[model samples]
Target: MRELLTALLSQDPTIEVVGSATDPYQARQMIKQLLPDVITLDIEMPRMDGLSFLEKIMTLRPMPVVMVSSLTQQGAEATLNALELGAVDFFPKPKLDMKRGIEKRADELIHKIKTAAQAKVKTLEREQDTPLALNPLSNIKFSTTEKIIAIGASTGGVEALRVVIKNLPANSPAVLVTQHMPEKFTKTFAERLNKISAVSISEAKHGERVLPGHVYIAPGGKHLKLHRSGANYLCQLTDEEAVSGHKPSVDVLFRSTSEAAGKNAIGVILTGMGKDGAAGMLELREVGAKTFGQDEASCVVYGMPKAAYDIGAVEHQVSLNKITEAMLNACGAAKDRHIRV
Candidate 1:
């Protein structure tokens, strides 16, 4: 398995196969020696379970970790927990059937590893404790919105948002996104979104106003909140204390929207790990706002949305294929509300 994976990564110039191990004991020693930039882990290592060893690594010498696993339901749940414990993400391993499915999945595996390798490593250090710096918000400026849409996500959020946003109309409502990304990546993510979707998307500048036809991503290392002044909404980027174990926490964004936009805001929680946005989505619902969560069948990791659903945070559950239509329906300018939300 290690040799095959090594050859696979070597085939792609963007990926460098640094080290590989099938057992936790060998993996631990390899990590100590190679200190590779990114580590790919299998859930069922021979010497010890992957999760137990992963806990040790996280509590000891934290670094970027990605879990490679089967796509089974059990594997999915385990992989999601690993993310909550600070593994950056997970990619479903290629199926074992010799004549089936593997060819179609190899590119996805390669892409995920490349993305993980490029993930900001330093952010893992005290990442859960990092606060939102309020400095950027001082004396900032913003554009007002007729109605603001607040969205929060993590883990597989990038691709999920891509699927949903790609289907939205140019006249869609103003959007504020809080995806749990690192500092440099949010800009890249926003730029990527901007290119793939008709709506303008950019990294949030402190005090930037919420405007229809544009989307703002909360800076990865900061916290974003909505503040209202005379019927307009402003994005206030800050370094205040971490909320729900994430710097740009989804809960913080949702709660602030509940406070600032009230009934005019639509809160959506997409794919991710942990219980971060569960409470906030409910708060959005309580204020006569609409709340939506990504359904389990379509999630890369169903942790966040499931947490919200279990606690009554979501008023609607939609699959990846239908979420953008749902968002459009919620926005009221679209021709239909027939889509799920």
Candidate 2:
């Protein structure tokens, strides 16, 4: 696996394979000697597990590191923990015909590694418990029509989405999320959010009614779009080919929101590696949906939002913490609360 990754990455003109290590001790020695810009770490390493080593690195060196793990329940949980412990991103270790699998996903691997290299990593502290439920909005009046919130994220989304979604009020609009993630990981991500957020969150199922105070995460390997069904909007999932190089694409969700909900939709583009949602966000703006982007300083990787901002798709460029309030304001639910923008 190590040899394959080295060979694959070395093929990229912009990337170079530095020293490779067989163990944590060797890795530490190589890090000191080579001082490489980015590190691709395996979750199951000899001498020390990746999570423990990752925590130590974040505490001491605080550099960009990406996790390479299997795609399973345990792997998903450990990857999430690694993110919280300061991993910039994670890539699933190839399964079945190792060399071919690696070759097939070589572009994705290279992209993630490059993105990780550019990510601004802050020291991660254990998160404090947040209130599980919010006070019901008293002063806000809901229109007869439903308001929809469309949120897109990638690289640092696990933590960034946590900050934004957990801050939403109990009466917030129905949210449709397209976070770049793998199949099983999306379910686990939604479950994690449901525990910490005021609103209910689940992986979206085809033909399900999009309800208020709930978030629908686009299932991995599928496209999540919205359809108007009488008085309610419905979730529609498709196995269309990858859009913007993503299956559960942010562009697909935002485009559907613009067409279906129009002015009633709120589009948010958060931290990510590339410009997947930028064009779709512009379409949303053209259709009168309010759009917001996370500012560069607050993002782990500022690529996506910066693209949106540059293209005029984003109306407001706010910090990560202020995104929920901005969405609530767009939904007309942020009247009395003092929200910092």
Candidate 3:
């Protein structure tokens, strides 16, 4: 596996193939000696598990680290944990035919590596095991069910969305999220977030009514769009061709929210690589929906938000920690009081 990754990475002249390690201990030594710009850590390792090692790295010496994970349920969970521990990004390991699968996704791996190098990596502090509570937003009453929140993210979105969703009050408006992830990973992602969040969160099913106090994550292989079923909002899933180079495209969701909810919607573009949600966010903003973008300092990769901000799509540019508060405030669910997380 190391040989294959090295060979594959070596093919790209822009990326140098640094020293590879067979285990975490070796990798630690190599990291101190070589001090590479980016390191890709396999989830499964011999001496120590990737998550533990990743935690150590993030706490001790923060740097860009991309996790190479398997496609299994366990792998999905571990990858999400690694992200929470402050790893820059993750890519699933090729399941059946290793060589063929890796070769097929060669371009994607290269892109992730390049992006990881430029990512904003922060030192990770130990997180609380309990669910977070935001008192300022919790006390505000949301009278209407018409209000909706649409969010789009990729790259570092796992951790970004986790922070945003966990901080939301239980009575917050319905949230529709489009995060770039594989088919197998999205279920685990939603389930993990559901466990820690105040609001109910799950992968969106076709034709399901979008409800207040719930978060609907776009299923990985399908695009989640907003539709009006009479007075109620419904989640509409389509297996349409990839837009902006992604399935469950953020543009599709934001545009649909623009058409359906218009002024009643709040659009948030989070940390990611690429311009998927920029145009759709523009559409939402033009239609009077409030739009927010994660600022560059808070992003792991500022590509998507930067693109949106550049095109005048984002109305509010804030840090990641403040996004949930901003969204709730825009929805008229936050009081003047502030509670620091």
Candidate number with greatest lDDT: 3
| Model 2 weakest 10-residue run by lDDT | 132-141
What CA root-mean-square deviation does each model show from the true structure?
Answer: 16.7, 3.6, 3.7
Task: State, as a TM-score between 0 and 1, how close model 1 is to the true structure.
Answer: 0.60
Residue by residue across 200-257, what tens digits does model 1's lDDT show? 8899998777787788999878998988878667889989888998899999999999
Which candidate tops TM-score?
3
- What local lDDT does model 3 show for residue 305? 99
Off by over 4 Å in 1: 1-145, 334-341
Candidate 2 per-residue lDDT over residues 133-252, each given as its tens digit: 433332354553378999999999888998888766556679999999998999998998888777789999999999888999998899999899888899999998999988989999
Query: Residue-pair clashes per candidate, as listed?
Result: 8, 0, 0
**Global local distance difference test of model 1:** 0.74
Clashes of 1: 8
Candidate 3: tens digits of C-alpha lDDT, residues 1-341: 99989988999999998799999999999999999999999988998999999999999999999899998988888888888899988878877998889988999999999999989888898777443554455666765667899999998999889888887788889999999998888998999888877789999999999998999999988999999978889999999899999998999999999999999999999999999999999999999999999999999899999999999999999999899888887886534467799
Query: By descending lDDT, how would the candidates be arranged?
Result: 3, 2, 1
Quick one: ranking by TM-score, best first?
Answer: 3, 2, 1
Candidate 1, residue 36: how far the Cα is off, in Å? 18
Judging by TM-score, tell me the better candidate of 1 and 2.
2
**Would you estimate the TM-scores of all the predictions?**
0.60, 0.93, 0.95
